[model samples]
Target chain A: MSSQPRRRRLEVEQIGDVTVVNFVDRKILDEQNIQIIGDQLFSLVDNDGLRKLLLNFGNVEYLSSAALGKLITLNKKLQAVGGRLVLCNIDPQIYEVFEITRLDKFFNIQKEEQAALQAF
Target chain B: MPLTVADTMNYPRDVQPAVAANVTISSDPAEARRIQEEIERHLQARHVSEHDIFSIKLALEEALVNAIKHGNQMDRTKKVYISYQIFADRFDVQITDDGSGFDPNEVPDPTAFENLERPCGRGLMLMRHYMTEVVFNQRGNGVLMSKVFRRNDNGKK
Candidate 1:
């Protein structure tokens, strides 16, 4: 087995029992990086046993449907393991995408990172 | 003859060609990215608002992905053709692919409780939500989308 560390697209930090993930300052998230982001988030649950997560979207301006799909997939996986995932700091314009798809109701969305961390 | 990017710029904003380049690209994601970047550059030059640009960019990405992934089925031999036009107040795009198309009516509603967990179908939903107009060709192998800029109360176009 090769022992090279995997390159991470998401910045992950551990805060008490919650894992905070900050999306890179990329304008768009689509097929090109969805898998990389997904794998990294999944590992937080599968390998690190970190179930409670806070996803920060402060830097992301646009999110493609594929990226939304990946988020749904990750949310389901985390739920299956009795974990929770919350998102915060979504751009108002980007939040409209969630509202349009009615995904805002499915995911726990907070206006601030502190609120999201406190919600857990 | 297809209109080139240069041709798009020469015509007055009101008389810009309705059909932009009808580009044919292989089923590569990089090609999709290139086309998206070109469209972004064009929109930026036109001074589109950041909010409007984000919406258009997301909608365009969904259309391209649908055409390349579902329409072409990731077959490198297949090609996706995209046509777009830019105006001072509106941007229009259309994408066509070579694969067998599916009925848009049959796509499940992603927002429904039972379907919320599914990862697919959100692309079409998003396109319809973001664009001012969204229309699929009769065969479902093609899509045309447009976004009109929102004017303030000043009545500016």
Candidate 2:
């Protein structure tokens, strides 16, 4: 580890009817990040009005298959309540993962947040 | 005659010098996932960060898939060797198969124009991005990758 600070900042926050999950730098979402995201989802499970999830991976370089599995799991959880999950500002490499798995057909992916929000 | 890493096959073999550690698996695709898990666990035991473990796992999986799909041509009778090397700050892994060597450079560039829609090239690309270094040893029969864990060791998990 270098003395410099890490450029990546991963956070999951609830904003109005949507949960904004931002991932920065490198993909793989790591196990720590996955647990955090799971925690966030669990905390918001009771919010019936929480109908949308916006995953912003613009800063992410690539997502490991493990991270993709986590995302798929989260997507399924969100779908159970009539809520939807949408991807925003995804990098090409990460997008490639979705494409390879044919997950793009299953995921609502958008290039911008407003577009993702509009799908709701 | 001294047995280089290539001499032994069809059974589990330990790689020499333990620069890190190694494991061998049958060419069965079913064994791929298990061998990968074992490799990841071994690295975690050595205190490698979770992030680096993911990188190693991804790179190693890609190599193993190549070993099966391209190298051994999916022949269950053959074998594959997966080796690991752990240093003070980095880990190097290599996956070799029993089949004859091939040209690494001949591999199509995943980022190139026509190859955009192809599935195979992307694995090599992902391996390159996730690892600090990737090489094809002189034998041209395997892939070698090293990853330097970039974790901040502030005693923080």
Candidate 3:
């Protein structure tokens, strides 16, 4: 049986007590890529036992609805474990999406990496 | 069955002045990226603004994903039909899939306070938010969306 190819779409870095996850580049995160990203984040929480996470959207120009859904899922997952998820450096276009959906209220969105880390 | 403007046009010369294309893709999620790239090239050729391109791209991806994943249920045997057109001031996209259709009205509002944490209907919300118009067929197996460009101070379309 052929196995599914394992690909890492997010870069994880440790800063103090928080894990900063940076998107690779300014590309659209579609359904398939969102699934890959969700799995990686879930593993970081479940396997690596990370408590706080900061998602850096500096290079992410666009986000599909599926990608936003994945972020919600990650937020709930982390919250259930008493952990927190902070998002930072969101592109204005992408930020408008969060505003339209009212997700901006539900997430801890910051303007910069320093602010996001400080929030944690 | 794929829906096309040519299906209803009786005269060749009556066709609208727009760039349009149609394709049938398998139920693979990866195909969405390729479709997005191809559409981006077409939009770029027409001098669409980057902001408008990003909005159109988001709505396009959501519609395509809904058709392939929800409408077709990721059945490899089933195919998703996508058609798009770029006019001078607007971009139009249509996506259809072969599956048991459901009413789009039944989708709950994701922005509601009680449903804030839920992720089920955000795609449709985002599509409606970004697109100038979003219309679903009565059967709910197909969706048509359009994004109209706003003129800048220079009166560019």
Candidate 4:
């Protein structure tokens, strides 16, 4: 493996037992990047064995369906393990996307980070 | 003011909308991003409304992804042709891919409770909702979409 560390797709933090993940990129529209994000999120559970995950969308400006697909999969993974995945700080415009696809109803979306921390 | 983007779809050759920012590229995500940013820059330079820009950007992102990934299957050998016009009042773009097309209607309603968790198929729905017009060619490999800038009587966004 190359000694150089790979660029981080997510900035993860431990808020109590919840893993808070903030995106490093504003636009989550790239395919390969989205795939990497999914893998990293999966490892947070599969490798780290963490239960509750909180995704902070504070840095995300735009995200495509591919990104949504990853979130769905991550949500499923956490559910299978009896854990929870909560998303917070989504931009209103991006929230409209979830509303349009009705994913807003499917996923646990919180208006603020503090509220999201409590959900988990 | 006379013919809307929808009405001109079936008009004679002379009725076609004017073209701008027309280019073709391989099914590369980087190229797709570049073209998307180029159009976004044009919209910014034109003083398009923030709401309109957001809508256009979302629609364009979904459309380009569909063209490059689904239409061309991310094949570098395949090319995605893009033609667009950034009018003062509206933005229009036509993206065509060199691949067998699929029917947009065939896509299931992702909003349905059962399909909500599917993860895919929401791109087309968002595109239609955000764009003023979204029409695919008969072959279904090409998509023509438009976003009309919202203007009030005072013209203040």
Candidate 5:
């Protein structure tokens, strides 16, 4: 029997000088998001002077503290260098999290992907 | 079939009611979403409100992940158990782990000025904010939290 398909999923891609990570198939972001984002950022950190780390949250429905923690960690890592983390197309519920934590100030959040890419 | 206060105090022997709803997620770090959904389903079945469900789920996920990653040392061999007890006025949850316990006092405050920028350290804060009462049982191996659910309709009571 083919084992049940994997439960959670994440997508990472290189768009121009920016690394666009799309978190998909997962309604919630937790430690999994943290580790994946951390690994992706770390992998791209030294090899490239990343222009922007665009987080496409179009598919993610929920964001937990554990996931938020990773975002904070990623923001700091990118900020240490000249790079910045840009977020776009976040769902309203998920957006509230950024608003509550005041992380919106720390992140360059745009309503559209084009705006995020242009910000870089 | 119903879980009693005394029943909650001790781990189940034959078929632990908590284990009945237990979800074993991966340490792959990518499976965090599954954990949240599982928690939400469990809470919803117990009639938790939509408004409060997210908080309970997030807090529970934080505690569970802490047990899976930090406390259990990310050992996949260990399991994190979550159980629920429905009281007349309140709902309670107990999250237990196989790892050794630690002092909750040592957990750094996430809202503190100096630690504001840190990524972690906010789990317990989120948990406490969502639940009405939070207790760390002696030995600190697990956490028992409860919230009194007031029925707005008032017909059942």
Candidate 6:
């Protein structure tokens, strides 16, 4: 990694055993931003040893395919640890992106965070 | 002779509207954001629908990344050329990179059961779905894509 200090890209909150994460950036479009976000997300699994994750996308208005790639990797990481990851509050347009890629089938997506929290 | 409204609508608007722009940048993906901002400002000025804006924005992000990262291999010395034109009926953009192009057909279907876990190759699928038209040059290093304007939609597209 570069010498630059890692800026906080995620707002984390704990509810019982589940960790809820919200992105600090509205547009997860840039590669560097997505990379940092991916590293931070991985730390939740490797470093923190969190089992279940609830990702709230209410604050995220835009994200690129690279971001989706990161999510897929995160999913794999969670599965390797026998953990789970759920996504909620995705915008309709963003939902369409997942649908187009047929990733909606791969990830556990809920319409609302309340519903998502229940999934975990 | 004067043209009627119906005729005006019928005639294919091959010409670029008054608002058109082109820019070239190093293979740096971050620099692509400046071009995205320019397109967003122009689309908002024309009162393009929100759905349409979202489509263009996402597709552009995918295309720019493909050009900078995959096409140019993140080589900052190379250049990526971007240009856009908005007609009454649609918005069009063309991105060309300096690297040798690869055949888009060789790209595997990310939706296929075996490929679902793959992280990359979904960008092309998003570009094809979001834009009304997406065409690549023979060399595959350049791409031309467009989105037709829409007033309202029930999510059919």
Best model per DockQ:
6
lDDT of 3 at A41: 82
The better candidate by lDDT, 1 or 5, is: 1
Residue-wise lDDT of candidate 6 within A1-120, one digit each (tens)? 846689999999999889999999999988989999999999999999999999999999998899999999999999999999999999988998999998899999999999998997
- Clash pairs detected, candidate 4: none
Of models 5 and 6, which has the larger lDDT? 6
- Candidates in order have lDDT scores of 0.81, 0.66, 0.82, 0.85, 0.67, 0.88
Interface RMSD of predicted model 3: 1.3
Two-chain complex of model 5, DockQ on C-alpha atoms against the true structure: 0.28
Model 1 CAPRI rating: medium
**Model 1: colliding residue pairs:** none
Question: A3-61 in candidate 5: lDDT tens per residue?
Answer: 54444355778888878878764455455445555565565665666657898989877
Off by over 4 Å in 5: A1-21, A28-33, A99-105, A110-120, B1-39, B76-81, B87-90, B149-157
Q: Candidate 6's residue-wise lDDT over B16-65, tens digit each?
A: 47577778999987689988998999889888888899999999999999
Query: In angstroms, how far off is A117's CA in candidate 4?
Result: 1.4
lDDT: worst 10-residue window of model 4 chain A: A1-10
Standalone chain B TM-score for every prediction:
0.85, 0.77, 0.86, 0.86, 0.69, 0.86
Positional deviation of residue A33's Cα in model 4 after best superposition, in angstroms: 1.3
True lDDT of residue B36, candidate 2: 71
Off by over 4 Å in 4: A1-5, B1-19, B152-157
What TM value does the first chain of each candidate achieve?
A: 0.90, 0.73, 0.93, 0.94, 0.77, 0.97
Least lDDT summed over 10 consecutive residues: which range in candidate 4 chain B? Answer: B10-19
Candidate 5: deviation at residue A41, Å? 4.1
lDDT of 4 by residue, A55-94 (tens): 9999999988889999998999999999999999999889
- Candidate 5 differs from the real structure by a C-alpha RMSD in angstroms, to one decimal, of 6.9
Worst 10 residues of 1 chain B by lDDT: B2-11
Pairs of colliding residues, candidate 2: none
lDDT of 4 by residue, B1-157 (tens): 3233345554233344443766989999899989988888888887778888889988988998999889999899999988887665678778889989999888888888788788567999999999988998878998888877898523435
Model 5 chain A: worst 10 consecutive residues (lDDT sum): A1-10
TM-score for each of the candidates? 0.89, 0.54, 0.89, 0.90, 0.68, 0.92
